[model samples]
Target: MSTRQEEATWTTLETFDVEVSSPSNRLYRNGRQQVEVTVKLRARNEDGRIVPLSEEQKRSVRLIDYNSGEVLPDIPASGTVATGWGTTSVRNEYEFFPGARDGMPGQIGPAEGYTFVVRYVQTVDAAPKRIGAQVRRDAQTVFKTNADNVQKSIEAVPERLPSFDERATSVEHGWESQRVVGDENDWDLRTVDYYFCGLSINGNRVKLREFTVRPASMFQWESTNPASEIFSFTGFGTPGSSMAQYNVPAAFSDRRHNPISMPSDGRGIVVLIRSNGIAQSSAGNVHKGACDVDARDEFGTDHPLRVSFKSSSNRNELVLTRR
Candidate 1:
C-alpha cells in the first residue's frame, strides 16, 4: 500500500491601481504652450504583492478627454515601468495642448475648456478590465480681441486743376497748379485712416474673411471705382467681396509693418476712407459719421465693429465701440 498526499492548487487574482497627477490650471489659447500630465499605475495580487506587467500590457496606457469622451490621439504617453517592492510602478508622461485644433503636435486652434483623464484597458483570463484616473477637473482657455481705443488720423490734401502756364517763357512749358495749397479751406481731398490692432483670436493669428465696410449718412461713397474708393491694407476685393475668394496671403495680415502707435503686433485690419470736397467744421459739411464693419473669422463667425467720427476746427476724433 502506498500513501498518497493530495496537494491543493489555487490562483492569485491580480488587480490594477491607477493614480494621476493634476495638469495645468490654465492653458494658452494659441496652443503653443503645453502642460505635462503624469499617470502612475501599479499591479498587485490578492496578497498585496507587486506584480510586473509585460511590455505589451504597458503600451495600453492612453489619455482621454472627459468632456469629449474620446481618447486624445495627439497626446501620447512616454515612460517605462519599474518593478520592485515599494518602487513597483508604471509611469506615463503626456504633453497636453489645450488649444490644439489638429491632432498634430504643433497645430493649434481655439480649444474650449475640457476635463482630462488617464485610462488603461486590457483583457486578462478571458475577461476585459478598464481603469481610469482623473488628470484635471477643468482646464480653462481664452480667445478674444480688443477693439476699444482704436487710433485714427485724418489727412487733408488740396485738389487743384491743371492750367496752361501763360507766364512760362518756354523754360518750364507745361501745365502747372495756380498756387501751393494750405489749410483746410483749400483742402478738397480728405483721407481718414482707421487703425485696427490686436486682431488675434485666443492668441492665435487668424485670417479675415467676408469683410464689409459701411459708412453712415455723413460719409459719401462714389459709384465709380468702388474698389479703389473703399479698400483695406488686408487686400479686399470689390466692396462686400470675400477675402477668402482671393485667398489673401498671410503676409498681408502681418502687423509688423503697421504704424508703431498701434497697441500690439496683432494688428491686421486697416481701413482707409477717401473723400472729395469734405470740409472741416463747415456749415454744410457733416461733422459726424459712423463706420460699420462686418468681418468673419476663420471659423466662419461674424464679428461687427461700430465706429463714429467727429470733426471740429481744433481736431478730429474717431471713437471705436464694440457691437
Candidate 2:
C-alpha cells in the first residue's frame, strides 16, 4: 500500500502602505521599492519551534495603476534578493516611492499623478505524495486465509482491490499576485512594481513613466478612483483660439471641471467614471500635451481609443508629450 502526506499552508498576515511623495519632500526614491510584510507559520517542530528551511522560493509584488492598469517598477524583484524578515516593525516597511540612489537601478519620482493597486504572493510547499496497492484476480483480496485442502474457486469476476498510504517530505515556497480592494480605502499596496519613470517638463507639458503588474481590466474605473488631467499654456494669447489634446476619452463628465493651476498657463481637469482611468497616470516626462487649434480633436469617449484635444484657449497653446 502507498501513503501520502499533507502539504504545508503559509499564511500572509499584512502589508504596508504605498508611500507617494516628491523628491523635494523628505521622502527618497531608491532604484527598487522595498516592501515589508508579516507571514505566520503553519506548523512547528517536535520541540514546538517553527520549522525553517532554505530553498529557491519566488517572491513577487506588483503595482498596478488603479486607473489604467499600467504597471510601475517601484518594487521590482529582479535585482534584489528575496529574504524573509523576523517579526519586527523595522522589517515591515515597503517602499513604493520613486527616487535616485548612487548605485541604484531604477528611476525616481511619482508615477505621474495617478495611484495604483498592489498585490503580493509567495509559493510554499504542498502536501505529500499518495501511494496505493492493488490486488486483482486474487482468491482472497481482503484477508487471505490458507486455502482448505482443496483450492477454493469462485465464478465471481474478481475486482481490483486497492489501498492507500502517505509519506511526508521536504517543503518549498513560491508566490502569486492578488488584488486587494475594500468598500472604503484609497491605498492598496499588495503588489510590487517592476520599474519606474522619471519626471520631465517640456514647454508647458509634464510626463511621467512607470511599470505595471496587472492588465487593464483590474484598476481603471469605479468611485474613490479619482482621475485628473493637468495641462499648461505658455505666455501670450492665441490669435483666435487654441485646443488641448490627450490619448484618452474625449468627453468629460458634467461633474468634471478643468482647473488651471498657478501661472494660469496650466489647466487641471477631473474626469469621473465616464472615462476609464487606466492610462491617466502613465504620462512620462516626454508626454506630449500640445493644443492643436486647427486639427479636429477626438476624445475617446465614443469608444476605446486614444484621447486628443482641440479646446479653444486664449493663452499660448502648450503640448504635454510622454513616452
Candidate 3:
C-alpha cells in the first residue's frame, strides 16, 4: 500500500500595530556600516483584526528597507513574523548593509517598508548639521558639520541613551519593568523582547543579515511586597555567526554584597562595560554594555562578585549575583 502525502494548510491568526526603528542613514566614510531597525508586531485574527497573542503565537517581526525605488534583501516573506516586546510594544533591531562609506548630504532621505501583519514602516533620514569656528592668523574659519559629516557609518538616533531622569518614556519604563527582583543569592528576572527586522547602512545598497524573534535581556528575577528586585542579569547572547558581538568585562568597578533596590530608591548598584571611561552621574542605574554594577556594602570594600546561578542556551545567557 502506498502512503498519501499530506499537504500543509496555513492559517491567519491576528494582526495589529507594527513599526520599524533605525538610525538615520547619514554616513561619513565609504565603507561597510550596520544600522539595526527594530520590527514590532501584534497578534491578529483571521479577519485581520487585532487580538491578544497567545504565548505560542509569540514570534519575530519581518522588515524591509525601500530605497531609491528598490527593495533590499533579508526582508521577510509571508506569515506571522516574530519580535521582542516590552510592556507596551515590541523592540526590534535591524542592521543596514554597507554603501557610501562616506556621508549623505545633511538632509532627509527616503526609506520605508511594511510588517507582515499589514502594519507599515514609515522612515526618513534626518541629518542636522553642526557649526564651529577655528582660530586663524588673520581670521577665524567657520566649520559647519553634522553627525553625517562626523562619521562615515550610520549612528543611532537619540545618540544619547535614556537618562535616569527620563523615566517617563516608554523605553525607560520597559527597563523598569525588567528590573531584577529577590535576594542576590536567589533571583528572578524579566526581559524585554525584540523582533529582528533587517540590516542596512546609511549610504549602502545591499542587505547583510536577517533575524526574527529574540529576547531584549536574558536574566533572572524575584519580587517583594513593596516592589520587585533584580538579583542577577546577563546581556543578550551573541548570534552563532554574525557581525555583532558584545563582551562583558570580567573586571568591574565595585563588587560586594550589593543590594539592588526598586525604581524609586536610588541605592541599588549597577554593572556595565564602559569603553569611554566616563561615569554616569545619576544614582540607581544599570547599563550592560556601558556600565557594570558598582558593588559595595555599607563599609565600602572592593571585591569581584561571582555568578552563583547560571542558565544559558542558544537563546539567552544568565548570570546571578552572589550575596
Candidate 4:
C-alpha cells in the first residue's frame, strides 16, 4: 500500500498580540555586562478573550534579529513553554551582551544600537488538517562606555628599596675599659612613595578623593609619623583600616599639599610608606613586602595599586636604593 502526503496551510493570527520589554537599554562597550530582554505573547480568540497557547505554538517560538530576519542562535533564552494549562500568556527572555556572537566573544561590534525581535508561530487545528500563524515584537538596545572608564594604575618611583638595620651599635666592657663599635649611617628609617596618573574622558585629570593602604603580613604602617600639617594618618599600626586623609590646601600653590589632582605625568599624588620595624638576622639579608593601594577618584571609581618592595634585616644597614 502507498501513503499520500498533503501540504499544510498557514493562516495569519490577527487576534494574537506580542509585547516586548527590556529592563535595560544600555550595554557596556567593553562587553563586561549584559542586558535582559523579555517578550510576552497574549493569545486571544476572535471574540477578543484570552486563551492558552498550544504545545505546538510554544515550540515554534524564537528570538530573531530584526534587521537580518535571522534567528538569534547564540543569545541564551528561556520560557518557551507555558507554566500551566490555564495560563493565558507565554514569555521568553534573552540575555544580550556586547561583543558577543553565538554566546562567545567575537570582534567587538560598533558602539551603536541593535534590534531584536521575538517571534511566535501559532498552530491551529482544523478538521483533518492544521494551520500555522505568526506574530512578532521587537526590542532595541544601545551600547555605551563602561562605567569605570577612567584608566587607573600606579607607578612606583623606585620599584625597589633598601631596608636599613636599626641596631648598628654594640657595647663591650673589660672591667676597666669599654668601647663601642658600629656603623653610624644615621639613616635607620626611610619611606617609599608612589605616584598616580590616568586620564578620563577628553583627556581630563581625575580628582582623587582618598587613599586606602593595606600592608602585607610581614609589614605594618609606620606609627612614627602619625600626623602632618598636610595630611593625617588613621588606623596607623593597623594594616586592615590604614588610610590617609588630605587637608584641603589653604592655597593650590602650597608645595606641601597632598596631590589630589592627578597629572598626566603621574607627579600629582604621592603615597608614602615606612617600615614596620621587623628585625633581620644577618647583613645583606633581604626581606620582601607589599601593600595594596585603593584610590577613590572624583567619579567614585576605586583604582587598585599593587606595590612591591624589598628591605634588609641587618641593623643600621640602609638597604633602600633611591632613583
Ranking by TM-score: 1, 4, 3, 2
True lDDT of residue 28, candidate 2: 14
What lDDT would each prediction earn against the true structure? Answer: 0.29, 0.21, 0.23, 0.27
Tens digits of per-residue lDDT for model 3 on 1-323? 11111101112222122122234323211111223333222323355544433222232222222111112223234211222111112222333222242333222222211222222221211222111111111113111112332332211221111211122122110111222433333322222211121111232222222211122212222322113333333322111222222232233223211222221221221221112212222213443221222222111111223321233221222232322
Whichever of 1 and 2 has more lDDT, that candidate is 1
Which ranking of candidates, highest lDDT first?
1, 4, 3, 2
Model 1 lDDT, full chain set:
0.29
TM-scores for all predictions: 0.28, 0.17, 0.17, 0.27
Tens-digit lDDT track of model 2 for 1-323: 11111112211111112322122111111212222222211223355433221121112223322223233323223432233111111221333223332422123223321112223211111221111111111222221111221132211111111111111122111111111122233223221111111122222122211111111111122222234333321111111213211232222222122221211121221111122323334423222333222111010000011212223331111122221
Steric clash pairs (candidate 1): 143-202
Which candidate would rank higher by TM-score, 2 or 3?
3
Model number with the top lDDT: 1
Model 3 stretches with alpha carbons more than 4 Å out: 1-25, 28-31, 46-60, 65-71, 74-323
lDDT of 1 by residue, 1-323 (tens): 11111101111212212322223212222112223333443333356544443333344444433223244333223221111001112322222222322222221222421112233221111111122222221123111111221121111111111111221123210111111123333323343333442234444454444445453222322322333232222111222222211122333233112232222222233333334332232213322345566655332334576645433221133345556
- lDDT (tens digit, per residue) of candidate 4 on 1-323: 11111111112222222222223223222111223332333333455543444444444444333323244333223322221101112332223211232322123222321112243221111111111112322123111111221121110110111111112122111111111111233223332332332324334343445444453212222232333122111111111123323322223112222332222221123333333223222112222344455654433334565433323232211121111
TM-score, structure 1 vs. true: 0.28
* Most accurate candidate by TM-score: 1
